[model samples]
Structure formats: structure tokens, C-alpha cells
Target: MCSILHIIGGVMNIAEIGQKVAQQRVALGISQERLAKLSDLSRSTIHHLEHGTLHEIGAAKLFKLLSLLDIQLKTESEVTKPHALEMASRSASVSYKTTISPQELEESLITGKIEPRTISHLATLIDELPLSLIVLVVKEISQRHKIPPKKIWSHIYSWANQFKSPRLAWQ
Candidate 1:
């Protein structure tokens, strides 16, 4: 998954922002042509966005695009710092039925064990999980998939803030 900041960060370069937009559009199952028609942007613009070559897109258009895909961009000023995560005990684990061991999951959460290639898949998975399970799954995937701990935590923090609930349920 693209970083939440990939779209929301004020300091992101054009290419990075475009990539985020394209990624979310794809995730939402919209084709470039369809997105162009919906956003009233040119097909060439959509193509450029997916290709990360769009020089400039207006803020309204960008916001509309993300909104259409169910992404809400929030600046740092609009969000608060995250409180510490309250993880569930191992006995109260959420069942993903993956081959990963509980011990491995615990270790990864403690010591950022990210595997880059798996980040996108993990992001997709995390999106569908209940809020109670998201933190654990993200931590597990980030550690096993080798994603940067700070980056994954930022995504979780933003999500937690968006939902107006910093506390996650494990049971």
C-alpha cells in the first residue's frame, strides 16, 4: 500500500502524490478512463497520474479523486499524535489462519521486521479487517514484510485518528 502520507503529506513531490492517487484508484477498482470521466479530468491526465508524470493537478480535482476512492486526506495539523497501542494478549489473538507463528508476530511487532514486497498485500488485508485487529495485523505484516516501523505506525495512527478512536480491541 502507498503510504497514507503519499497522498496527504503537504511536502510530497508531484510524482509521489500522483502515485498515491493512482494506487488508491486502482485499489477501488476504477479504470483510468472511468476515473477521468468521473473526476472530469482528461484521459491523458489520468494516464499521467498513474504513470506518475502529472506535473500539476488542482487541489479540488485531487480531493475529488481521493474522495471518490474513499480516501480522506488530512494534514498533520488536522490530526493528533497517537497514544500507545494496547495490544491483546496472545490468548485473545485474531485468527488470520496464515502460517506465521505467534512468536514471530510478537517479535516483529517489537523489532520492525518488514518485508517490502508484502507491504501492498498487507495494506489491502488491513483495510478489510476490523479496527480491533488492524493494529496487530499491520504490525505482523510490517515486521514480517520488512516495512519501516515508523511508516506502518504512521498509517495506523492516521487511521486511528480518522476513526476518532485510538483504542483497538483485541477481544
Candidate 2:
């Protein structure tokens, strides 16, 4: 009996929390998309919350919207800061910004100032160039500049395609 009591006492239940949020949304008869627009959050966020994808949404953003809609966030003294859920949510929100442009990355390649391997790594991370697009850009630069860009272009192309922006989920 003591073991059963302990198991029930220590369990953290978030189902009631989720239900409360859904109840509010349903009371207003507002769709997830509409709530997203009103809260300046992505539609997926509202969808995930209603469907109980709470792990994908950060506690900060979730509470933010709850506050906007006059909903309260409750805790049983078991909550902790900076959960994995928060980190995952933040990953989807990060945008890519590069120090150089596609033209510059290609120019560095053509000038022989950059190693082929370095260019490959940069292409994967540049986001703007991607792999296929990088090849086109590099080929154009190599042709106009009289550089032997043959296999290098195709190699980079294959490698760049493998990268998937994890942040795109939130976008």
C-alpha cells in the first residue's frame, strides 16, 4: 500500500495542463492557426500543443502564449529549468546567417585560396548555397575565372544535399 501511494504521489501529470489549454481554445472556438496568428507563434505550435506535442514546444513560449490568452502555468514543485524540450524548440527557431555570400564562397574557391575540403564543409553550413546551388555558383565562378572546377562541383553537390536544416520544423 505504501509503494502504491508513493508511485501515485511522485508521478508528474501534465495531462490536466494540456486539457486546460485545449478547453480555452475550444471555448473561444478558435482554430489553432488563428491562435498562432494572434500569438505570433507558428501554426504548428498551436497544433502541437492541442495534440499534446508538448515536448516540441518550449516551456517559455508555451507560457508566453498562455499568458497572452490569460491561461496560467502551474507546477507541483517538480519542474526544472532548461529542459530538452526547450532546447528542441529553440533549435527550430534559429535562423541561418552567414559571414560571406554565395558569390564570396565561390570566389574563394576559384582563387585557389580555399581548399576543396574546406569549401565542401562551408557549402554544407552556408545554407544559402546548399549543395546543388553551390555547385552551380562554383561552376559559374570557375568557368568565368578559368579554373578546373569539374569533379569538385559534383562532389560538393552530393555532400550538401545531405544536410537538413533541423530548424525548418518551426519555420
Candidate 3:
């Protein structure tokens, strides 16, 4: 099975972690039985872990499985904020005639001021940007502009309503 896993808020939920493990095991051409034997775990355990059916697993066992699969977990503390902001700006600028600058986007977001020209771009951003990037951008903007995160979210919610954004995150 193929799966995509996204870690948000510096954490991977259990299902995503399981999907990662399954991806790595499949990439290595390792069967569940072989993986169980190699990791000194039961085949049922491996199956449950890969299928995300297991309720909980010990850290040592998870670490051993990941070690066997050569999967390393990483946390992006300082790196993700700027990258997400840059990505958001780039996403907002994907227009034909008018492009919204990062500063303009930030100002608009903070002050609830949407320029007429950038409305379409902002709507596209609201509709298409990944939820994680949206969350990161909101967090960065809130911290930098001294606006409460709730206020920023309210602004986004208003934009989403005005634009009729189809994205579930915005909805």
C-alpha cells in the first residue's frame, strides 16, 4: 500500500507514524513475517502496526522497528516557520497579472485589509495552501504581529466565507 504522511505541530499522529513504518518496510522489500522475525516481534504485531490498528506500542519496540527500517524521525523547530511563510507567499503570488508580495500578504492578514487586486490570489491561497502551512503561517503572523491566533483564524474564516473556499481546513 502507498501512503503519504504529514507531521503537524511537530508531532506525527499514530496513524501517520504507522503509515511511515509501512512505507519504509515496503520500500525495503521486507514482508511482515520477515520484519517480525528481524525485529523480534510477532507478525500480528507488525501487521497491526502497519495497518494502524494497534492502540498503543512501546517506545522501545517502535524505535527498534524504525531502527531496523532506517527511518529517523526529525523535528523542524526553527526551520519550518520561515519556510512555511515563504511557501505561503509564493502560493499567494501565483496569479497572472497581479502578485501579492509577502509584506502585503502579511499586512493584509494582520490588519484585515484585502487589496482589490490581491483578492483572487488570497482566495486561491485560502483554497489551496496546505493545512499545516496555514497553521504555521497563522502562528508566525500571530507571534510577529502580536495578534492573537484566534483573531488571525477569524480573519481567515472571514476570507474563506467571502471567497467560498472549498478547502475543508478553511471550512
Candidate 4:
């Protein structure tokens, strides 16, 4: 289980904090566009922050982003001595498998059997993967769910389009 932490009192650096934020976001399978919408920040701002190029983030926005990522930035005095430097743990609870059987995956998707709450997990699992891999998965999904691959592809495309440039809210 990967987790992100930010120690505010003695270890607060803008660049490091940005990296931590990016780590948390990716671990959550969240895209920058989604993070921006949830935090009310611009995609460029999210990009800059992830790349550690943004400085002087406002407190409200910072809080919003951290809260959305399930991150905790704590002061030194709030914690005990030995663990005083540690921020609260926000673990990526989803356990992702490297290879899910097509039938199982199809059934999971059709029956809403995924552990994570969002359907974006399907996109995340497929993103940057090979075409053969995608085809195999899609074939199973189509066969089990009785939906054509063309339709599934359309939905995936629409979701990708939305993710590429997310609007003001979760769609």
C-alpha cells in the first residue's frame, strides 16, 4: 500500500510537497484534470505543482488539494516526539492486479464488483497498455456484458476525452 505524507513544520518545501501531491494523485488513479476540478484549480496549475515548478500556492487551495488527495499536512506540535515529523498516513487502499482474467474483469465491471468506487479504474488499468492487452480485456467485457466492443470503445473514448479536459465537476 503506497501512501503520501507531508511534514509541515520542519520539512515543508514547495518542491517536495508538490512531488508528494503528485504521488498521492497517481496512487489514487486520479488525473490532473480531475484533481483540478475537485480542487477548483487550473490544469496548468496542477501540472506546475506536479512538476515542482509552482510556488506560493494559497492556503485555501493547498488545503483543498491536499484534502482531495487524502493527504495530511501537520504541524510539529500536533504529533509526538518520535513520530512528530510524520504526517497522517493516507494509503492507496486499492490493490491492483497486474493481470486480471478477462472473464473475471468482465464480470466485475458488469456486476459492479470492483473494490474502488470509480469506473476510472478501468481507464487507469488500460492507459499506456498495449493494444493486444486492451483487445483481450475488451473482448471479454463485450462477451460477458453483451455490449459490442465498438460501444465500449466509444464509452472509453468519451471518458478519455472528458478526462483530457475535465469540466467543473465529476461527470
Candidate 5:
């Protein structure tokens, strides 16, 4: 849920929000030290955001950081679905005939810019990847559950976070 725009309300300078988020992190028992290491975000970015000093933090970086701290800016419950599914009466046949764009993956990391749903979307793509890299993921899950690879992958598909991928969280 959108947190009611509660930005230390009123005209403020840089780093104010950063300070607030940082304070929140501390309250949650996450120190700047650990957050930096785990999130790969600088202590200064944390510092700057809290103080509102970050001149221009792209949406992607902002969400990623907030996600790491367990802060979700927007809530999907407030949004409506596309309604396209209702028109679908027949099963769709998809073929893994396209090459995956490694650049799409790299851009998020390099630019720190991402869309709201991008992370969760990518999580599905990663889990669905049929190439060799993902084969072992199914194999391992199958071994642990004593199920066939197809069944294990089916379970994984069903259990994937529907609202959003774990984002860079589990990376």
C-alpha cells in the first residue's frame, strides 16, 4: 500500500527521506553496516536518501533499496488487472524459440533503474529459463522432494511469488 506520501511532510531538503528510511532500518534491527554489505548500496546512499541529498535516485534503485529493507512503495492490491485473461478461452502454445536478452538483465544492475514489476517478472523468467543453467535448479529441487523433475518444476512454477519476484533479494 502506498504509505500516504508521508515524507517528513512539508518542504524539506535532501536526505530527509533517506534519514527516515535509515531510521526505519535501524528500528527493524538492520544497521547501515549490514545493509550496505547485503544490498551493495553504499552507506552514503543510505545516508543521502535519509537526508534527501540524493539529487536523482532512479525509480529502480529506490525500489530495490526499499525492497531490501522490506519497504514496498506501491501495493498491488490497489491496482486492477489487465482483464485480458477473460478473453482467453483457448490454451496458449508458447515455444522457447527466442534468445534471452542478457543485456536486459545487465541493464538493471548497471543503471540501477527498473520498473515496479520488473524484479518479480524477472524472477519468473529466471526460474523458467530452460537452458542448461536452469536444469540443475529443477534437478536439485527434484532430488530434495523425491519427485520427478517435471513435477518439481511444476511445483516451483506454482509457488513463485505472484505479486512480485523476490527481486534482487534472493540474488
Candidate 6:
């Protein structure tokens, strides 16, 4: 059965798409096997798709599955959100005379070792940047650096407390 989901906007990676699909399926109380049968896909495909482990699926198959699940993909002309590194760098640069490069910011995040020169910029980031952006940055850095996001968040929490940040996200 083709269910209609209105236009889903924004730039979503495959994993995020898979997550949405999984949530929809669960919300509908549909079993993976049932969805697979209805969509003419394999149960394994459903599992992998839900878990974000599927490397790729044919466009036709994906469309069929999404149709059954009532998800319609739509593209928008708007500019996409900035990358995590870029957001972090720009936020850190705000209110600072010296700008922090994306590379330096990324290195500091991954290593949990802030350079003396960039301390002020990092402090600004911890103090003023939105928590959502911080989470996105942590997720990106964790994946790229092979470190757990929890460890990165711990470092951020420590920095926030040390800096006495007024941002509610840090609190």
C-alpha cells in the first residue's frame, strides 16, 4: 500500500534517512518481515536499512520501501547547513580578534588538547555556541577520529565548567 508522506526537506545523510524510516516503521507497529514482504524486499534488507548498516540498495527497491512506509523524499533549493567543522570554527571566531581555522579546531576537538593560542576561541565556543551545533561537531569528530562521542562530550562539559559558561546547554 502506498502511503503518502508530504515533502521531507533538509539535507539528510543515509544514516539519518534510515533512522527516520525505522522510526516510522516502529510507530506504525509494523514488523520488518511484514514491511519486507509488502515492499517486495528481504527481511535482511529491512534490518540493515533500519540499522543504517546497508551500504546501498537499488533506487527502485528503496522507493518501493519508502512508498509502503509513507515517506516521500523531496529536494529543496535552499543552501545546506554548514559542516560541523565550519560551524565550530565560525562560532569560535565570533567575538575574537584572532580566527580559529577549521583544521585547528578539528585537531583540538579530536585530541582534547587545546592549544594555548586558541584557548580564548575555544572558550568562546564553549560559552556561546548552541548545544545542537556542539553535538553535531562531537558526532562528526567522534566518527572521524574513532573516539566515542561520550568522551568528547565529557571534555566539553569539563571545559564548560572550567570556563563558567552561562550557556544553558553546558549546564
Candidate that would win on lDDT: 3
lDDT of 3 by residue, 46-112 (tens): 8988788988889899878877787776655544456567788888777646778888878888888
Best by TM-score: 3
Off by over 4 Å in 6: 1-82
Stretches of candidate 2 off by over 4 Å are 1-16, 77-171
What is the Cα-based lDDT of residue 67 in candidate 2? 71
**Global Cα RMSD, each model:** 15.8, 17.4, 7.6, 18.7, 16.6, 12.1
Selected candidate, larger TM-score, 1 vs 6: 6
What lDDT would each prediction earn against the true structure?
0.55, 0.50, 0.80, 0.60, 0.48, 0.79
| Candidate 2 local lDDT, 115-154, one digit each (tens) | 4444434534434423434434554555566766764454
Q: Which residue pairs in model 4 clash with each other?
A: none
lDDT (tens digit, per residue) of candidate 1 on 37-83: 99899999988976888888888887777677666555653132122
- Against the true structure, what is each candidate's TM-score? 0.39, 0.35, 0.61, 0.41, 0.34, 0.52
Summarize candidate 4's per-residue lDDT along 1-171 as a digit string, tens digits: 434564643546778778988988888889999989989999999999889899779988987888778888765632322221111000111344343444434554445445344444454543444343445555556665677778766654565564562432213
Query: What lDDT does model 6 reach?
Result: 0.79
**Backbone clash numbers for all candidates listed:** 7, 0, 0, 0, 15, 0
**Candidate 2 backbone clash number:** 0
lDDT of 6 by residue, 51-145 (tens): 99998888888887787788877766433344877988988898878899989988877677888889899898887777667777887788777
What C-alpha lDDT does candidate 3 achieve relative to the native structure? 0.80
Roughly what TM-score does model 2 have, to 2 decimal places?
A: 0.35
Order by TM-score, highest first:
3, 6, 4, 1, 2, 5
**Which pairs in model 2 have colliding backbones?**
none
Which candidate, 3 or 6, would have the higher lDDT against the true structure?
A: 3
Which sections of candidate 5 miss by over 4 Å?
Answer: 1-16, 74-171
lDDT of 1: 0.55
Model 3 quality (TM-score): 0.61
For candidate 5, report its TM-score: 0.34
